[model samples]
Target: MKKTCVHLMLLVVVFCLTTIVQNRAFSELDEGLGKSLKQDSVDVWEDFLNTLDRRGLSDPHWELESEDKEKLINYFKAKIAASVSEGLTSLPERLPSYVHRFPEGMLQTLKSHAENVLKVNPHNGAAAKFLAVEAFHKVNTQISSEKYPLLEKAMVLAPNDIEICFFAYAACTRLGDQTREEALVALERMLERLRGGDHKVSYLWTVRLYTSEVAATPVQIYLKINKKHPIIDRWEVVLTEILAVFENELLQTPDSGVFNIIAYIYEAVGDIAAAQAVFKNLKPFYEKRLAENPKDRTALTSLANIHNKLGNTDLAHEYSVKVNPTLAWEGQVLPEFSPVVDLDGKPVSLADYRGELVLLDFWATWCGPCIVEMPNVKAVYEKYRDQGFEIIGISLDTDEAALRKFIKENQLPWRQVFDGKRWEGPLAQQYGVRSIPAQFLIDREGRVISVKARGKRLNALVEAEIGDTID
Candidate 1:
């Protein structure tokens, strides 16, 4: 499947992309008094079901009967009725207007339509998922006893659906009971399907699908709830299954997809020793690929990334030049810019710090995550200031007063540059920075060691760059 289709599928799973109630259409449907609403609701039904069909919600491996199609459309009528009665869409902007209580009338309509679909086609995963999402959302984000059955039914109906499996696992994580086992089972099943060759999707695709904000929130909730559980061990098993597939695939084909997924899985699991070993073993495969087809962009980029991760900075840069030298990575020289005045009107330039390890921190005073990370940044600075470590804060804040006030109150000693353009500031645009709290760790030679040094990782990268030990 294409990446765009995968994204749309994610939106559909989270109930955010479609199902907007056209006020006129819904009003007309409402006036019909239930049974007569059917004709007026077909447009709404088509809007919902067509979106699902386009987004790959149904199993492409299975064919739908004519009767099943009718039942599926009816199933969406429940969803439409619920959406209309609640006076809300699942769009992010409409979330503030959410209604907590499921109206008795709305519930009755949903139940009737759901029963209509399930009685005909009990394996209707989409209907089961709709019921599950509604049940979870209606109770003010609370876990209800009623939700478990719907989630289980959804899993049973669509064991191979990654979205449904995610929902099932996510819902299961909320409870403090044996549901943890079920949650793992759901995730394991998802991994099994991805690796079984039944679906043409890759493990990396599954990883990307879950990385989105909407999809990740539930997993975050799971982590928070299961703090005492052996989170790493259980998840490591699921990830290992994916690696097994990659390992087997590599024996036959030196595919970049398989190699990249293997690299990501190792890094995600935090097995640095294993990651080093795997990347080392996989290096020759990419080298041979490039040797045969020197213009293979995928191999060139992958080889550069592998070398960078393995701390082979020189080799990383050599391969990176073959791909795109402008792309920042370990051993790539920091992009040069003319000397610019700092917040205190002192002239500053990266060239001035060519022999000093520096951190180019792009952040704003108004950014919440940046604010939260200030103390940690301060700690790193205080520990390394005398040992040749420096931080250049590129403030992406348009508010000069707030920026200065935060700097003064916090007693931050670093030089800051502000252009009053927020994200449009020159330094930010120069580096293609799209988000804040982004830090680029520069070595003493003015080479970027890492572009994502933040939080606890900041301390590690700074230490590695400056070659210093902090007590």
Candidate 2:
């Protein structure tokens, strides 16, 4: 089984148990239905019961009562959870491959279960939330008309539910005026409840996850399409509330992982100063922890990460070296290389690009995200090529013909290195590239500067490095 599938199943199991156990909502089993459910081919109900065993509901015939509306809500929750587990087990690893690749059978099964829940209790917000999420994931761009109303309804019915509110908020950003307004109102309602410490809502971790994903959407869209989303102003309202909430949380529980979350949010919104301040504030806490325990792994790791982001490279390396002796630090000289040739059988050397700002882009023809990122990278390259800015394309493509065709068709003007070894290519190994679309921006002095210089940030970094007249 795929690792993603396993992890997702574990998370779903944990989340479902947490919900049911915390709510303490169990019902007597209906004998005929329970027997039929157990005899069902997939045994989802049996798995859910097995999962329920740890909560001391281990009776063989025990199952949720489907007739009771309140119990039915929890019952459907477990049903949806079981369906997801089944789907993950049976489906491909790439869930984000979206509609074209998503199994039609699984989608219909989930849709049917969600619809059944609504039939049992039309007011069941969880069912509405599930359908909204299903619709949100099934499309490529915007939420369709068929899905939008469901999403809007979920927002109205489950305003306190993080997933529902988040999907509704995201969908609204892609929609028209009235719907956007409705989503904003719903988000504000949730924010107010969160501020008031409403127990109906899930706590910090889940809210933080939703906030992080929402914060990242605009950045990801900008990176892919090279356009600031049309609803950015609306996003600002949401971000401001997020910042306020996290800031308040930090004041309540200082020196927590919430610090990292706040810093990430600031960075996502391009508030560099605010982000660095959060990191700087967090530094002393980890530093003091490291001082107390010289070999504290958590402290060492956190300090290293924080210092790296703070541009204190020497400090970052000092902490990182103590943790992992062989780890390379940012701002060190780019690693020396074995002889390699570009796609045209021409020799390629990093040393040749010395005294020029260069971006080493690790990408491949088969990677969808890598292709999505091309337009932004290409635009940055064209804008800065005359001012000592260059990009060395490190193509992790096993098929040289496909790579060549893509390059030629895209009219990419940069030199490209390819060994047709895919992820095992020497250039990728030298940089410890584990993921496609990995990028490193190196300075004129041949020192590694930024590893995540992509999207609009790519243009900004290149322009800052080489687009200005040097004294």
Candidate 3:
């Protein structure tokens, strides 16, 4: 019995010693981790301060002394080198604060930081996300071959990040000639992730995706006919896949926006029967809302527009009357505008072209539809300039350089109003120009003749009105 008691005493002594050793080790490890976290926090603050100082020098009015500039540059270089040497593992955590302080001019630095992190740890998802955003920014500025490999790498590293996946899909779609299959794969992955209940997929991103896919279908068809592009050889199959995805999305939530997109996609792909069916399905929803409230402008306008598109002109006219009873139709005199200066500091006003028919064209260089219609406008101007036809272009372009370049390249001889405030320029606001490529035709008496004149319709209207004077 004494021997057994002695054995139990030895076992208790050993257990106590082991427990004490473990407790000491854990306390030391906890201290070390706390120190590391504290150090990281300090580094993050330093990075933010440096970023702020760098940005402060970016102001056009703020001129930095050569010595100060050199010092700042060297400081940043040293910091970046240190971060790279340390593998930049903590950079992802610090990046958000740094970016919030200085959002501009940090792309290259962030790209380098992410690359360094990936070199150290290939599975760094946050680093991969930064790289993906950098690539997206690059591609949006202009299509390039550099964005794809980075996007592919990001997808492989962070397969579940919705933003990364969406960006990859965007890059693929933008450069669709070579990346159609990749786009499909990225889109599929995005949808799959969305289905997994990740609410991180934003509403705007979803809408953009739907619009891009639908828009690409028409472009692909055009390319196939014009260029015989083999990239879209299996466009029908790809379009079917896109339709399936849209149907699945609609099933999840019967959104009017999604329904509209699906209908457009169907029309673009030449599925008229399916398009009509979808439109018919949407008719009841709008009608139900209108029945609840007859004066709902949104419902009234939607019904009018859809019916007009479907050639139900009687129904369209009925809804249109309900929406606007006064009929501010063509031939009504438009509001007069005071004098505004053109880009070259020349004063212009509606009265300047009183003796001639005028076209007040509200447009912006950045607007896609406006750019697409510009050639037609130029052609019309050239054809009718000798017939006392004048154009007064009101540009909503904020970038002065781009506007000037576009005008010079296209040789747009018409006077332009450019105050550098997009959408809020004096003429744009005065004319209630909420959208671009807004056209208004003025008769020789300065009375508005047609407000919706565009393309061949504009050509016909001009020819009809000015045909008598053409001799």
- Ranking, TM-score, top scorer first: 3, 2, 1
> What is the lDDT, from 0 to 100, of the residue 75 in candidate 1?
38
Candidate 3 residue lDDT tens string, 318-399: 8876775423435677666866899889988777788898898988999999999999889889899999888989889889
* Candidate 2 ranges with C-alpha deviation above 4 Å: 1-184, 191-201, 204-255, 262-338, 343-345, 349-369, 375-391, 395-414, 418-453, 457-471
Candidate 1 lDDT over 245-327, as tens digits, reads 66776776766666666766776766778878878878888889999999897788889888999999988878876665334
Question: In candidate 2, what residue range of length 10 has the lowest lDDT sum?
Answer: 86-95
> Cα-based RMSD of the predictions, in order?
13.9, 14.1, 11.7
- Please provide, for model 2 over 1-471, each residue's C-alpha lDDT reduced to its tens digit, 9 standing for 90 to 100: 699999999999977875674344222222423533223423433343343446343355644433332323334445443332211211112222222222355456556877896786676565666677677663434445556778777656654544455555665545544354555654665565466564324245235334443433333332333225566666566657666666766676684577886787788777999999999999899889988999898999999999999999999888876775424535788866679988789999889999999988989889999999999999888877888899999998888888889999999999998888886877776676767788889998888878778887887777777656322
For every model shown, what is its TM-score relative to the native structure? 0.47, 0.49, 0.53
Residue runs of model 1 more than 4 Å from their true location after superposition? 1-42, 45-131, 134-150, 153-163, 170-180, 188-259, 262-301, 307-313, 319-340, 346-372, 379-392, 396-414, 419-453, 459-471
Best by TM-score: 3
Error of 2 at 329 (Å): 11
